[model samples]
Target: MASMDVSAQVSDEHSAARGHCDVELTHGLIITQDTIRIVDNNQTRVQINQGNQLLVRGQWIELDAKETEILEQYNQMIRDTVPELVELATDGVNISLNAIENVVSGLSDKEPEVLKAQLQYVEQALRNKFKRGDDFFYIAPQSLSKLDDFFAEEVSKKIHTAIQGSLGAMLIALGDALESREGNIEERINDVGTRMEIITAEIDKSLKKKAEQLALKSEEYCNCLNMLDNTESKLQKLVPELADFDLVKIKSDLQYSTH
Candidate 1:
């Protein structure tokens, strides 16, 4: 809202020594050579002994309505320009500190050329970061590193969006693939269950045939009962219900038949 004011200050005692007053806006400190100009929301205070036409020089001391509007427009232009530069740079580029320094140094002397160089530097840096991906995240320090990366990612994403165009089909395809994979897993599980059932039926038939082949003698039947008990114990490890099988009753019946 406040424009910079540059003024010449002179006092009666030290009128020979021409002094200048330039207030630093960035810091809220009042700085003056021999006089001070204080402005508030209400009014402005100008302190100087007005001697008729004593080479008074000031930059309007403040901005008028028109000047303020123009200043705002210029600020907005700067903001817009920087983002555009970042986007352009991030496309595919590289920038060195030296390049940036050179561009900045030339800014005062060659305004147009310096601006172009600055844009190029920004673009190169951004492009490099985008290419680096996760690796580039921690490369920069706190000062300007974070800001540079932020701008680079923003620009890179913008470029990607522009190139890729539509995302609707891609999303739909992803969803369909996920659904298909889930169905395949369910079918495989059902197949496994069917195979397990067939295997269990075959094992049951084999166990019955083995029991019929063994002849019952007194000691042999006792030993056979013991072996079956042991077998059932082992089977319980694989199938929990096998542990509840009538091992004790079967052993008693075999012993009775043998006697």
Candidate 2:
């Protein structure tokens, strides 16, 4: 079993686009091929496993004779949905990486080896969050936060480094410009410096735009997972035993709220 935490902050646009109020995941969910486990803050554990098995607080629950019908219905729903969820998650990772690559590739004609390696690391990190073994796949709660950090922090840092590295080529161009002019070296130097500032500003503007795009994509991915919370709600309603047990809770907060 693998575990991770995922958090998503919705933008006004995202909320409007989905036609729903902002939502957040209050607790993490551990999803496997045949089971979904929710561990609350108080260390209370509730799990729904294959074959209509339910465990609460580490004890197997015995359903009433009439409850068997509800159990079977829940099991069938899970059996129909888990594979689709896995497919959607896998696709989400691929789409995110492609988005990152598109942003990073714009930095230079030929992408730096360092950036390529960083991308690989990111892919591996994301894949690690979704554990797939011989017979099961798992989605941990931490995966969304990792995704957010990858684009917001790690990728942003790499982009800045790569952009700064390109300044060396600019300096070489400055040298060539200075060599071609013989008089007024100080004036020429100042002129080159001003042009360099302009170039730097342009790079910064481009970087900011790319970063915004990445941030939006990250939020979009997180928003997609909101469906999982909806599923959890449905399960609770279907199984009376789960009425008080929150398999997954999503809450909305203002700090990460987007304009």
Candidate 3:
């Protein structure tokens, strides 16, 4: 005859087995779902399905897995698509800054009629530029006053030169002023372009990092689902034979001699 040691915990005292095993897990006075299990060294080795399933066999192997079926509820937390972030930058310079710069550079070479035409062109560009917006460059507001001030200074100097009495002197003054102004304008454009390049690279880097993170998380989630599916299939195959289980005989088989 084999000896059995059993321990039972029942909140309101429920019927237990006739002391068959060494340890028995029972929670009878529970209002909600509870569990029955086998405890080995205070660790549960056999559990009657209540919550998450964690199996420990022998000394080293354990199988604990989560199912992604539950992830459907929180799937909305994952972003559907990575945003395409773009950054555009422009300063007080107009869209036609290049064209105006060309006109200014050639002012000394053009006749007064040509100068008048070029001036008219620049005037129209300024008007349109003020109304235009850089939709991509949304980080900062367009400094409208700053743009107006720049245009005002440029026009004031050029108009003053154009209205001079002597054509030779007028050409010299206009050429000098425009050259200086064009140099400054070129510097600003170059600066803006360089900054724009930096911004674009940063945005690209950020998007790439986010894509990698999303991919990694998706891979992990998929792996969890696969593990759960495999585990459930294996359990379904193994658990039905429980009707023929003989615990006392199995324990006797596992008993070993100590030196």
Candidate 4:
């Protein structure tokens, strides 16, 4: 593999400032200071003055000295479109929750906490989506931090991993809370043991599935590492193969690998 190099050039003639990097992008460009700019495969670019303005642009939107027309258009879209999408998301939960509850009820033996946990999860997830916060995915731009740009090719992938992570975190917390309730159920009726066992079994099954997935990825990652540097990864190798890997994390390995 031929190593890549990157540097910057400025218009100044007398004393030119320069910096070099070995950074690689799957489908994007990163220009370092003297004015850093990154252009994605889709031709969307993020330009920064290293400290001042950051611009993310792709396609024209007429933001110059335009009018109240565009402002009103965006405001209308935010009011109409945002709530419609929110309601749709909530409706989706309602439908899925009904189905899940139906199945849980069959096995629930009228246990209150079981259904409570599921409702709480759905309600809380939806609630978090609407509230303005650091974690909330805000649609309306405001005085909050903005993403200059994200490599477009990874949007679907990023969403998938994000949802998977959110679900995993919710399950871990729900399982813990339910575990406590299981004890109270035990004291009330010995038959409660069966239902708790059922709930625990379900949780364990989900957790196991997640673990298996992680293990598979870990194995693949180890194989990828071995491909990059067999001597370094031999002791750490776990996976026998890999489907594919990307260069996003290569620079992270240098310090530790050198040590």
Candidate 5:
């Protein structure tokens, strides 16, 4: 992974300037704010717009009552979940920031402005990826991929730099504070270490709860994908050209794990 020069002055504009890489999906679905597009094995394209208009092979197709009902059902499903998904993502970001703050609070009194800035950047990135439009939301495989990269590359670097710059000062301050207390310096240091471990364990437990929630949500999402699969199967029966086009295979790329 290539590293970008992150300036000391962390700002929203700077974070926005470091735009995400383009993600290409040769196959499967690509969902945007108002459209859902699928590329099949034979390179055939299928698109459905917000108006429930279906397009295939560069031509718009007229839908019967049943077909229109299926499309409406799918659209309703997505609409209902969009807010819930946004809430979950927001909760995840809050959980992460709280965990970081907890750890920092255990170490020092100083605010972790840099770390918080980076986390805010992450939150904004997530919001952008899962943007809600007038009547729809976006969901693409690349959203997860981009977030993974943000954490692994950008966030990790900022965290490492922050720790390196502050850890020694934090330790010295902690040591001086503890020195005035009863116990020997070494024993007090050990006690502080033990307390830090306990704090870390508590943070881990909280994170696990969030993970469980995410797992449950992933199951619901998988169910939705299955319904979409069934809907597409019905659509294929109605439109023979789409018989070979597989929209649900995008679920495989999702790799949602209960574990």
Candidate 6:
């Protein structure tokens, strides 16, 4: 009779007559919802404690190096699947951001009259459907910035130049009257100075109000640009992780490793 190793003996008499394989794997088998029990060819019985623990109760059936390596490989393969799913989620976020940026840019690049009309529609929808009032003004930084650019380059310059030319003509006339030594020259000089003072004050007040409005508009534009910059920075940091979503490559690697 072959002397069997004492550590490899089975507890039940019905299972003791199995072949001497020294040790057996109790866990790490083909586990699914239906099947729960796993035994290694009856040489030794393995009682699964949980998902990954294998207990032999009274026996110390040890696994060889090959068996241990196989178990490690299976666990590593399972862990590697997680990063692939993360990459897919990141890709979806990137797609959403791209779509939003494209829509905003397209709307802004339109002609001024068309853009103004479109913004009016947007404002109405926000008020009617979304229940957002003049909040559209707060969110329309980019659209408003584009409008300001149009006004500054096309409208404000011509209007300011016309106003300055009119003021210069009035000043020249007043200077001519003061330079003469005619009757009531002193009265005309005082009258011209008073009118000039009034015109200067009005012009100063108008310019100050316009400057304040332009400053506010510029601040809004800068804030929007800053927000976009932050969003871009965050997306760039995640790009490498996003690029790792190669499903074909992951599957190929898993197949090659199994063989």
Q: Tens digits of per-residue lDDT for model 5 on 1-259?
A: 1233333333333333223212222244445667766655434387778847888877888988888787767655645544565455445545655666677676656644665565566556655444544554444333322334444444445444544444445566767777767868777666656665565455455545655564455445644645555676777787776665554443343333222
Query: How high a TM-score does candidate 3 get?
Result: 0.21
lDDT of 2 by residue, 61-100 (tens): 7876546566656455545544444444454445544554
| lDDT values, one for every candidate | 0.31, 0.52, 0.32, 0.33, 0.54, 0.33
Error of 3 at 112 (Å): 34
lDDT of 5 at 158: 48
Give residue 46's error in model 1 in angstroms: 24
Candidate 2 collision pairs = 4-141, 4-142, 5-141, 5-142, 6-141, 24-250, 24-251, 25-250, 26-249
State the weakest 10-residue window (summed lDDT) of model 6. 132-141
- lDDT accuracy of residue 106 in candidate 1: 33
Q: Candidate 2: lDDT of 97?
A: 48
Candidate 1 RMSD to the correct structure: 44.0
- Candidate 2 at residue 207, lDDT? 43
**TM-score to native of every candidate shown:** 0.15, 0.42, 0.21, 0.27, 0.49, 0.23
Clashes in each model (backbone N, CA, C under 3 Å)?
A: 2, 9, 1, 1, 0, 0
lDDT for model 2, please. 0.52
The residue ranges of model 6 lying beyond 4 angstroms of the native Cα positions read 1-182, 231-259
Score candidate 6 by TM-score against the native: 0.23
Best by lDDT: 5
**Candidate 6: residue 143 Cα off by (Å):** 20
- The TM-score that candidate 4 achieves is 0.27
Model 1 misplaced stretches (Cα beyond 4 Å):
1-61, 91-259
